[model samples]
Target: MDSIRLKIDSRADQVALAGRCIHALSKVVVGERAAFEIELAACEVINNVIEHAYECREGNDILIEWIHRDGELQIDVHDWGRAVPADVLFSPLPDIDHGDVTNLPEGGFGIGLLNALSDRVEYRTDEDEGRNTLSLFRRFDAAGISR
Candidate 1:
């Protein structure tokens, strides 16, 4: 599989650069629709890492990789700042009271959105090593299916 890799310091300022690259690459293989989906998911994952993974610390780093081959696209996001417990990061998002916009939650949609938009979503973490890996996959060929 041919892949493109990007390494960024875990800072908010660098996210835009990563997003542009991911969008451009996805656009080439799956066109704008798939690419936009990828962008949304990628942004959520990156933001979560920056805000939570390195929480209460500074100078962490993360790497994003795009693997494309045989009509499949896999995104692997890795970080070494802090390991998120599977129960927290992999669980489904809690239902919010949307009827009352005044009481709406400020967060809690990252994993669910990612799962809803990708064919597969998997997360692994090792708290002792302060490492986490999130893998998202999708098929973009003629048989491609929407999330």
Candidate 2:
């Protein structure tokens, strides 16, 4: 398997750059739609690291690894800041069935959307080492699957 690793400041502005890198890499194997899906999921993951893990701090580092092997793509987002809450990883989807768009919740969709876009999601955190990794996985071939 081949991998591309990127390390960037945990800033909101850098999320787009990371997303673009993910999109470009995924496009080669999964085409546009699936690539976009992967990119969006990745951006959400990065944003959560910034907003929650780093508490919106600017100087922390977030490392993203894009790995492709055996017809699968795995995106690993690593952070050395605050460890993610154990329960957040398995949180259920947001309750958007209010039948009123204006009454919808503004937040709480990050993990859900990440889960929906990728075939699998894994979260690992080691407080002793001050490391957290959020891995998003998807299976694809040359022709990719549609959403």
Candidate 3:
């Protein structure tokens, strides 16, 4: 199948719309678990871009694309905002404490979840062009092994 691509504003609503498109495609091929994983990862990745890189700025366009090849589904997120520091982009993931409500942090888990849910996660920045692209992937067969 041909890859699907979208160019959306760097706003929460538009980002969510982009994510919904991925969710719809995932649900049809993968099971509910994998579908949700893909959907959540998509949202988290964009949220990080919005919060950190774009600084919640509006009007900027974010590029999102979905491609399925060789039993793998790939999602690419591109942004023209300020380049994120490599340390922040590749930091170690934090642990989640779901059982303890009081100990739960308000944020800081998005990156970890993005890395965990997707089979592979990569970030590349075009220094001269001042652009960044995040690539996420999910591998599945008939049973849909997204996790």
Candidate 4:
């Protein structure tokens, strides 16, 4: 078990860093299913930061950390951007009418996907400092079953 840290800038770099993390973690994960689940969850989270945190600004930086401990993988994403409202952040999934493609929104599904994929999701923010921290954790046993 090890810890990996990355400083990501730019949307492209965020995706690249996520891919690298997934590749590295795959080597230690017990099964393909767990690895893929974590990778997909991370992808959605980082993409949300790129799209909403800094509003696609080019210079903003995101700190990503992955820790493997006690047969669990934990991810922490830190950003210095406008703080998202707690109410909206924890709100239930939006009601999407399948036929309304014209009015369909581009975002809001990342958090939902992350929640479904990860065993645990936590968030913290400091409005004055404009910093947001999101953490996700998933546990895998030696048998490759999620605990």
Number of the top-ranking candidate, with lDDT as the measure:
2
lDDT at residue 51 of model 4 (Cα atoms): 73
Error of 2 at 14 (Å): 0.6
Q: Could you give candidate 3's per-residue lDDT for residues 14-111 as a string of tens digits?
A: 87798789889878778777888898998888888888889999888888898877688899999988777666755556766789988877777788
Clashing pairs in 1: none
- Tens-place lDDT per residue, model 2, 48-119, is 999988999999989999999877999999999888876887666688867798989898888888888989
- Candidate 2 residue pairs that clash: none
> 1-147, model 1: which lDDT tens digit per residue?
789999988888888888889989988888888898898888788888898888735577789999987878888899986667676756566588779998786778887787778888889876777678898888865655333
State which candidate has the highest TM-score.
Answer: 2
lDDT of 4 by residue, 47-123 (tens): 77777777888788888888888778888888897666655555445568889998887767767777877888888
- Give candidate 3's TM-score: 0.87
Candidate 4 has its poorest 10 consecutive residues by lDDT at 85-94
Total clashing pairs for each candidate: 0, 0, 0, 0
Q: Model 2, 118: alpha-carbon shift in Å?
A: 1.2
lDDT per model, in order? 0.81, 0.89, 0.83, 0.75
What number of backbone clashes does candidate 3 have, counting pairs of residues 3 or more apart or in separate chains?
0
Ranking by TM-score: 2, 3, 1, 4
All predictions: root-mean-square deviation over Cα? 2.4, 1.8, 2.2, 2.9
